[model samples]
Target: MSVRGRRASFISAGVRFIVILGLSVASCWPFRQSQDIEFTFLLPPGRVECFYQPVAKNGSMEVEYQVIAGAGMDVDFTIVSPHGYLLTSDFRKSDGIHTVEPTEEGDYRICFDNSFSRVSEKMVFFEVILDGQGAEGGGDDEWADMVEPESMLEYKLEDIRESVESVHRRLERSRQMQTLLRAFEARDRNLLEDNLWRVSFWSCVSLLVMLGVALTQVYTLRSLFHDKRRVHT
Candidate 1:
């Protein structure tokens, strides 16, 4: 074969190999669709706060919560179904995980009640995860609008793109996990510091009280031992 022809053959072979690799990667990529929300908020005393989330029938909903900072490290959590049924109820709980599979398609309500608290407000960290058909519907249309493979090479390229997108999603998840960790650590540190301060304050107060008692006793003894009759004479 001519040198130019040989070079062309090698380039074609390389392109084919690259395309095949891309297709394989895409075929192996994993896809998932869901909705998640996280937040930290303060619930004031004598207040009732509620949030709503829409979910499709047969969908799964999960909630996890912790009292990050509060008067008692506990709060009231309640989840109501779309059909006006109470799914989960927790009173004066520091942390909990709740899950439900809804049978109706409608807006579900989650509430944090602080009405029972007369003076203490609560700071809470909570997350909700919903896995439902409705959440995946838009994703399906997006996938359909993506470029279709016209040839085997294009097919491989599409696969490569999917793999890359999967990687991107993983990295995003990792970042989110890191953020959550930091928040948890900060909350814990604050609690620790507060407890330490309380301990120190009490220790100082107890020491002063003891010293006052000792001084008072010493003065009382000196008064008792004094010769008042001799002084009068």
Candidate 2:
């Protein structure tokens, strides 16, 4: 084969290989679809439930989540970081799209409050879509290998959910205690007021009795003195 022809053949092979690799990578790239993940929690009135969404840690981006409330109930949401920072907060907003951005790769907490709902929240969904360049990586083997035992995102999120749950339980107990205390306080106040009113009523009655006795003594003395004065005159 001529030297130039041989070189041309080698270049053609290289181009084919490059094209094949490009196609393979593009086909195997991670899916960044929003519906890939779904998280739901049911909280009774005046309670909060939280969950985590896995995200790419290396990039600077936001986790955009779509929240749909079960008919009749609205949701109030707050995004907390692994470190317990309020990254984002919203309230009284109807079901719609929301976004949360993290500074680093870690657990991001989305707290769903059910207190806003008078009825049960039958369904709440969280769908995570990568913002940019989203790569889930190559082969099934490569994908499996990239997954850590527990991602920082998962770990931090779990911790936050636990914290919120603990706080939720505490809040429930506190509310109950406060209600009982208020009942007791109200009863005591009413009883004391009633007693006070009764005491004043009796005190006034005693004062009138004392005044009546003094008047009787004065009249008796005046009658005796007048009789003596009349006899002397």
- Top-scoring candidate (lDDT): 1
Cα-based RMSD of the predictions, in order?
5.1, 22.6
TM-score of each: 0.72, 0.39
Model 1: what TM-score? 0.72
Candidate 1 lDDT tens digits, 1-233: 99999989977987877767666645643445566788889899989999998777887888888777867878889999888999989998888889997546888899998898989888888888776546333544556676656554344555566667778578766866775686678679869988999999999999999999999999999999987775443
lDDT of 2: 0.55
lDDT of each model, Cα atoms only? 0.78, 0.55
Candidate 2 residue lDDT tens string, 1-233: 99999988877876666556445544554443222343444456667788775555544334333333344435677877667888767675534445554345666677777676665553454444334324344423454564333332223323433454466456655764564455445445645776788899999999999999999999999998775444443
Clashing pairs in 2: 30-136
- Identify the leading candidate in terms of TM-score: 1
Model 1 regions more than 4 Å off: 1-33, 132-169, 231-233
Q: Which stretches of candidate 2 lie over 4 Å from their true place?
A: 1-36, 40-44, 54-71, 130-233
Candidate 1 at 11: error in angstroms?
A: 7.5
